[model samples]
Target: MKDKKPRVAIQGIRASFHEEAAFIHFGEDIQTIECSSFKQTFEALQNKEADYVVMAIENSIAGSILPNYSLMMSYNFPVVGEVYLPIQLHLLALPGVKFEDVKYVTSHPIAIRQCIDFFDEYPHLKVVESSDTAACAKRIREEELTDTVAIANTLAAKLYGLDIMERRIESNKKNFTRFLILTHHENVEKKDIDKASLCFQVSNQVGALAKVLQIFAEQNINMSKIQSMPVLGKRNEYNFYVDVEWDNTKQYDTAIRQVLKYTHNFNILGEYQRHEDEFVQNEREQKFRAQEKITRKYINVKKIVK
Candidate 1:
């Protein structure tokens, strides 16, 4: 007997980019279950209906997705992996509809904001929010509204059989969304190329946050990103979420121990190997080379002056 494919849960419709990321992470052979909302997606995993869930936690244009962070604390799911997808917003509408005919636009709220410059040109056009980008495209196809358009991705337009009125409609060309691949199991093996995400709350004291960060500085751990979110049920309290890249050669153990010594509440969200994609790898390499060049130039100028 053949084994069944792993079932992954995604928070959106069939043509949603979350679905695309899921396929990219888990491969096409994996089965996918679509949920209408992030809550539903978490529930699907909790109920054992799906083996894993994929959800977007942040976007380059919009910053952190606070609701997902709250959900992460509420749920017991572990983030097993992460993937970044470039977001390209497209203006999609029914066939034969011209751009000038668009009187109303529909899309996820973030998508609407991402294309604010384009929408601002037509002050008379009404903007409506949908649950998701692909969901808006589906509505445009289902209702066959000639005057209404959906601002979504090109993939969504193709999947819903809608015509693209405009391509690359986003306000920024470098927009990207970062998603977390979550699972019920927390026992995944940590790899050598692992990045660790942690969340903690520092006591409300002077230099508390600084002292916590100083531990990483002493250990030479490079922090990739850090953000603070308000703590629920506690007035005037905030928790910090941090992502750090550490050397896996036992040196990280000292850093980890030092971090735990300073912070009160600490949770290791996940330590997983970063995704291997040409675009991301190339970007990292380019950044390192640029920094190296700057350092070498500084040293050369200092020597010349001396």
Candidate 2:
């Protein structure tokens, strides 16, 4: 007998980047519950409508997703793992529609911003901001808008049956997004822990934050990320969110003890294994390369019969 697949909730439709990250983490065995927004994604998890939630935390080009950090502080969900997914934006439109046919381009504002350089060459095309990248693609297909194109991932294009007019159209080729796998606090396990997401606040004094960081340095714990979010309704006060990595559990435990002495409202959000980038890339790229290899074999056929 086999175990039942987990139901993962994501913000957007089937072909969004969140869904892509979920598949990367859980493989193709899990079921996805699409939520309209990040808040809805958390609500689905809180209501037990999903076994886990895939949330994008940050992007290399856009920096931190501050809203998501705020959501994590409010929900206090356990961060079980993370996945860094490379983003590839494409220009997609209805079949047989050429570049001359496009009058407007629609996508999420962030997606539009990433391709600003490309759009500069074609000043005639109007860029319209939309809710979600995949949603924009969906709109074009459902409304039969032949004059508008979408800027989205290849997955969205394939899902909406849109032809990709251009590939890798993003201004920066190094764009990647980091997504967090979240679960209820009680369900979180400390086994195989190497990376942790923590939140705390230091007393409003000079050198206070530096002392907390020094403790991590002394204990041999590496600080991978540190972001500060303002404490709501508090003037000039903030809550710091930090991600740390450690090779030894004992070192992390000792560091926490020292860190606690200098911080306020300290919270161990979650401690989980640091997902390797190579593993995710190998699994994802292999499938893509295999398909491409098959296509190339037919297109460039010169068999050797020795």
Model 1: which ten-residue window has the lowest total lDDT?
A: 185-194
Per-residue lDDT of 83 in model 1:
92
For every candidate in turn, the CA RMSD to the true structure comes to 2.2, 11.3
Across 102-163, the per-residue lDDT of candidate 1 in tens digits comes to 78899899888889898777889999988888998998899888989988877788888999
In model 1, what are the clashing residue pairs, if there are any?
none
* Every candidate's lDDT: 0.84, 0.89
TM-score of 2: 0.88
lDDT of 2 by residue, 1-306 (tens): 037878899998888888999998989888899999999999999998988999999888888989998888889888999999888999989989988888999988888888889989888999899888999999999999989999999889889999999999999987888999998776677788899999999989999999999999999898989999889999879999999989988999999998889998999888899887864567558876998999888667755331
Give TM-scores for every candidate, taking all chains together and pairing residue i with residue i: 0.92, 0.88
Whole-model lDDT, model 1: 0.84
Worst 10-residue lDDT window for candidate 2 reads 297-306
